[model samples]
Target: MVVVKGQDTSEPGGVPAHPAASASADAGDEAAEDDRRPSPDDLHELLAERGLAPDDVDQMVDVAAVGITARWWRNTKVEDWHAGSAIGALSDVDMYRINTHTTAKVRERLRRWRREQGLHTMVDVADADPAPLNRVFYNLYRWFTNPNRTLIIGTTLRDVVAQTLSNARTHPDCDVPDNVTTETELEDYDNQVAGAAGYLLESMDEYDPRSVLYSPALFATVWARRWWGLPDYPSHVDRVFAVLADPGHRTWQNRPIPPPPDGVNLVDVRKKMLTKPWELPDSVCQWLINDAAEHYIFD
Candidate 1:
């Protein structure tokens, strides 16, 4: 799938459709990674089995509005005036390094981060946690037309949940739902992303008949995550990650996907990540916290 610049609407045919990633581009090369990630189909089946779907937004306007709302929720605190950071960084204990974090560790940590931080929504997220995710959301959310940050796991639901919980937790008065289990179901990073893919599949398929809840534009966001950067980009990360970290998007860069280490166990990996104790710039980390104050009127 080729991403076209300035074409933000993810309506039908808004973006180019390459064959689904489950299929491969190169027939002869085993090295060529055929979007081995689970297809939306497989995920939809899982969601259906679990009985879930999108709320069904009314129109493209509605899609963009909800999308924008979610992003706005994330970015309410990009500036440093309210942030307590002397130079705009979270304290040493609060800083969570994206790299060096094992996939195994990220998943459990992501969920736990949410539970401890209280980040179900923006208000809750900012009121308490105040991490960098909000800033990135604000910077990248181009009226939700740009799926730069708002996919199932990559940006939309998962990003909000993960960022809120992980950055520093979100709400204080808001208690985690009694039904919401703090247990760790999926531990692997790939598995977390995979579960998101599955949820998106179910959401899109069911909402196709009569709603704006899950529009085609979302697929574009998904496409971008799978997007292969040109040869010029870094080897480990794709272009999107690079773009977020680019000079222009510095405030939005936040944490990285963590470095990939071969043959590392979870316990050992967490030990290593904790040792570094680094996050994105301090200014970026506090955006969520500040924004939450404004939105949720956090005390």
Candidate 2:
């Protein structure tokens, strides 16, 4: 795919004198004025004269072709793979552009997709059942291959928290809560929430089985806020955990209905409940109820 330019090695009559002809003045003079052009071999010699060895020229051509092939494959094959699903209907050219996208561009697109899918944090993936988890894996896999995919996959609670914070940072309209502007502040908040969630999940034996089952809804409410672009204040975060820690303190309801906070759009929440209530796991439902109760108490 690489073309190398040849240097002109013509003499006065556009002919090159043969080596043997140079032994005699008369033969050299006759060959010099022959007016014949150089052959392929003569061109090679001319290129060599310019310091480009045959082997070096071959290597350069090969390297250039390889680089072109690699770019084409990355921008073609990967793009088609993503187009296989209804949700991923990007054109070949669009996918190619995405393949070559800068980090900020990729993150912006990823944030939009997350918003559309209502996926706020890595915890959503971590706590997902097999079906949801597989969907998440497939979505991520379509964009990138193995080692790079690892960058988005979270294996631990801490990793999930870190990923959640990272996503928040990428969101253009993100409204970080007070005390959570810097990396250190965000990490501290992550630790607090993770510790609380872990303690609640682990302390299930201490609470009534019915209440413990209901506790998942409490966590779900917190997760839901993330989907709605609402900030998770420390007080509310601690309160959700506290309620989970003491499930027996309050009666468990079949459904916990939380009033939408001021400025929070209820359209998506309402739509999900009306059309896809099953998507709201029991934990999320409980959190909704507790959220309503807390709102009432504060009011």
Candidate 3:
């Protein structure tokens, strides 16, 4: 990152013309040092050297401001703004009082200073993956588009129930009642199945029923606390299975067999079973089988 400085007049030859040019070259060297990654301690040291107090720094600088100018500079293909320019923006008096503010505050101030210098984006200083900065950009973008808009977690128990019903309906062997259309109807069905599963789980305590639900290949682990009884335990297990079944869910594992319309043949499904057996109840497997069958048509 080259720091732009005032152009110096050079002699007719390639050499610098005067002693002032030598001083400028030295300042450029210092500026190069300033171009290194900025940290809280460095900012504090720079301010203390300048004799700025905390209150003085805050009054002159908006420490909370994002480094927009720095980002803009980088985006526009301008000379990189180094720390020297960031500190140089402050008045000598304000610069002297930099120690009074917290490190975080000073960091923000420096970031903002970089922004004021025409660096408007976070990517200007970002050394590696700009994911965090990208998120900030996204939030700002969202805010600008709709000030009243707020993010909400869309997943709900109703959604889980609906997903489970969808899975059952698509399964080759599982029997799903026709009347279970609405979310309310699905929830009732889920409750019934979960109750039965819970009873079975409790009765068969000698066997770790979870072994059936645990698929190492799928990276699926349905955890339940010891204190949780049948209905709750079964309900949670159903939820986990439902999540795994839906590709729309983030936790859904990618399978060699795609979803319906393409329709995977039984041979491929059997192959998948051998490699990564579905760790779910027989009832759940019925839905998975039906779902997998939809992905491809059999000969």
Candidate 4:
């Protein structure tokens, strides 16, 4: 939550304020603040000084960065979510003060940083099988809900998990495992989800699926899609179209969608869906932001 120093910080009606609204309101102040904030490269150098990498920052922050990946819209409504998530991610480092990498940039950093640590991306997972995805989530759910496990249920991660489970359980093709088959079963696990965004690998063995699946691309996309009321399985055109066609499913109010930026092809991008935006050109970052703001979620 973005707390203004002199304003009422209480969440009116208990509904979290929209990122765009908060961001737009604070744009002038944030621009001044950003001047004092470390650049992404500076942040990386600081992390290296303290023997940490981007991955050590925490998943929630990463997702938030991905949500507003491009610096193109900094100091705008787009920057609001980024500011909160980045600050939260930096809090985990105990040394560094901030992070500003997009999902693509973060993934690139991971590909390089993790390689130095002898970790590589999973290349053979031909399909994003929800069974494994659910299993990974199920374990994370267990960990998050466990009182013995000292974990802080940060806002971003809590929102991500809640949204992910909702997507997994509702997507027509999803075959949710019996263990986590019902909303009540999991809802009973924990009542209040709050705290600084974070993750703990201590209890997770080397072979744990989260080692590969607990990713912004893999896990956080659910939360990202939730912005536009999109469900899991981006490849599922039928479901995606169904959701798009239904006025009721548009969680946010309907708005005028502007023409996409030149040289940007939404169809081509969708065809290559889940291609890991960072792996492509930097423009993919721009394309995603354009799609989200002008075409999909906001206008």
Candidate 5:
């Protein structure tokens, strides 16, 4: 059997049709093409699998209206906004990213990053726990389009949840869900990012200067952990080891790390953890942080 972009192109008697002929045949078969497309029922079934009610689509639209700033969604397209259902919005997002000038290498990095952040599809958003309906709507809309901050450091779903929880901790008026993330989960996530930062610090010289690690577009990534409330390396390193020492701890189950030298069995360490700690001079690090804060993160 011959396959092109996942479509079977084999003809009768095990002979493969010419690629152009196959394309022409497929394009001419309107009823077959329509059959191939997902129906409203199919979309509803997908959402239902994640426990979302049909009305939840409206909630998703409202969230996207507020959270998304892209011109495609925000300006002169209000009709299109309402016309496009939740799944259509996701499809539009996918197409926009495909049409953008982002390099293939960067797109692959972003794909991996999104997978790491626990975002793969609308279903994944609906599956995030703790009041999955509302929280899922938030996740769906927040990640529906690529935010500029997404390319910045410290924008993981865990980081966002932790930050929201921390803000609520510091300020009583912060409007966040009561069960978005527990304090224990917050601390666990903090340690995970810190250990990743420590790993990056240990592996800095191993990367080439031309690599994404040194790219100005992602300069803020070097200090992502700090932006997400891990302020100092020594303290961060201490937390990492502290988490490591607790064999029963919950931090490494999802984000695994290397086992301790003392034969303490631990989860397998994944290659090239995404966290990056600055190896630059203090002055340069300060400047980069200030620049990102002033011009990138908040803008």
Candidate 6:
């Protein structure tokens, strides 16, 4: 929600034309007003003063400072979502950082936003047996806050689509147990995953396995956000693809995707996925922005 510029301050049952409707307002004052807003560093001090955990004030707020308010493409919930989730991860001492880091006052307010009525998907990477990381390749992905989460990836490329299908069919309980299945059997593996995704698509009546693939890569985020009452979904689909396409994505790093096996329409696969509906929390955008500005998510 947003207040329009030059909108009337008066509310029918809301605030009196003057100012007494604030939750933290004083007797004579309707709402609290500050002469000057605090800077990111100042906000850290405010949260520290209020007893918030140091991580909330220092790291999270520091991370959030990367975002500049975008009024044009309005999306209040996205920013609100960050404020609520970050503050919830803080210690009581650092609680005020919500006010310091962002304009939100409600500690866990974003958890139950009714606007979350739309369908979405998520993939939890369940500590799959990754091949290996190169020297320059950092296991750059992992949830520091919530360790037990899954990650997902979307692809209908012949190899990827087939493998997703096989995953659903051959290994009915694919994710339940973690194992290193040899890619030595690439053809057989692709056939399996393809079968799985295909099977799920056939049954629209039940939960589609598509949800699993479409919404991959938010394991660490979804669980933590879920704890705070917010649905772990991105504000838009392009965000999902941007992340999936990133060189840091596991799919790109795990094992180089071999050139689309002979005659596999790579163009069609890319178009299909790029045009498909996907969602992800705006925190990732904030991250890219932060990285661009601060050199990285953390110093």
- The whole-model lDDT of each prediction reads 0.28, 0.31, 0.28, 0.32, 0.29, 0.24
User: What value does the lDDT take at residue 209 in candidate 6?
Assistant: 24
Candidate with maximal TM-score: 4
Model 5 C-alpha lDDT per residue in residues 8-94, reported as the tens digit of each score = 333221000211112122212333333222333443454345333423423222222221121112121111211223211222222
In candidate 5, position 52 carries an lDDT of 34
lDDT of 2 by residue, 65-169 (tens): 221212222222222223322222233333222322322233344344445555444333233233432343234334332222322112322332344444444
- Pairs with backbone N, CA or C atoms under 3 Å apart (clashes), candidate 2: 216-283, 217-283, 217-284, 217-286, 217-287, 218-287, 220-284, 256-289
- Looking at candidate 6, what is the lDDT of residue 135? 11
Q: Which stretches of candidate 1 lie over 4 Å from their true place?
A: 1-187, 207-292
TM-score of each predicted structure versus truth? 0.19, 0.18, 0.16, 0.27, 0.18, 0.16
Which tens-of-lDDT digit does each residue in 21-66 have in candidate 3? Answer: 2212222233233233223333334433533332232322332221
Q: Which ten residues in a row have the lowest lDDT in candidate 6?
A: 66-75
- Could you tell which candidate, 1 or 6, scores higher by lDDT? 1
lDDT measured at residue 253 in model 3 versus the true structure, 0 to 100: 41
Top of the candidates by lDDT: 4
How many Å off is the CA of 241 in candidate 3? 73
lDDT of 6 at 239: 41
- Where model 5 places Cα greater than 4 Å from the true spot, the runs are 1-36, 62-248, 252-299
Q: Write the per-residue lDDT of candidate 6 for residues 1-299, one digit (tens) a residue.
A: 11223444221111111111221222222223323222223433443453333232122222222111111001112121122222211222122122222212111121112113221211111121112211101111111011232212221123332233344334323221233222322333233223222221222112322211111111112112211111212223334345434667554544432333345353443343233212222332232233222111121
The reply for model 4, stretches above 4 Å from the true place, is: 1-3, 7-81, 84-199, 205-231, 236-256, 279-299
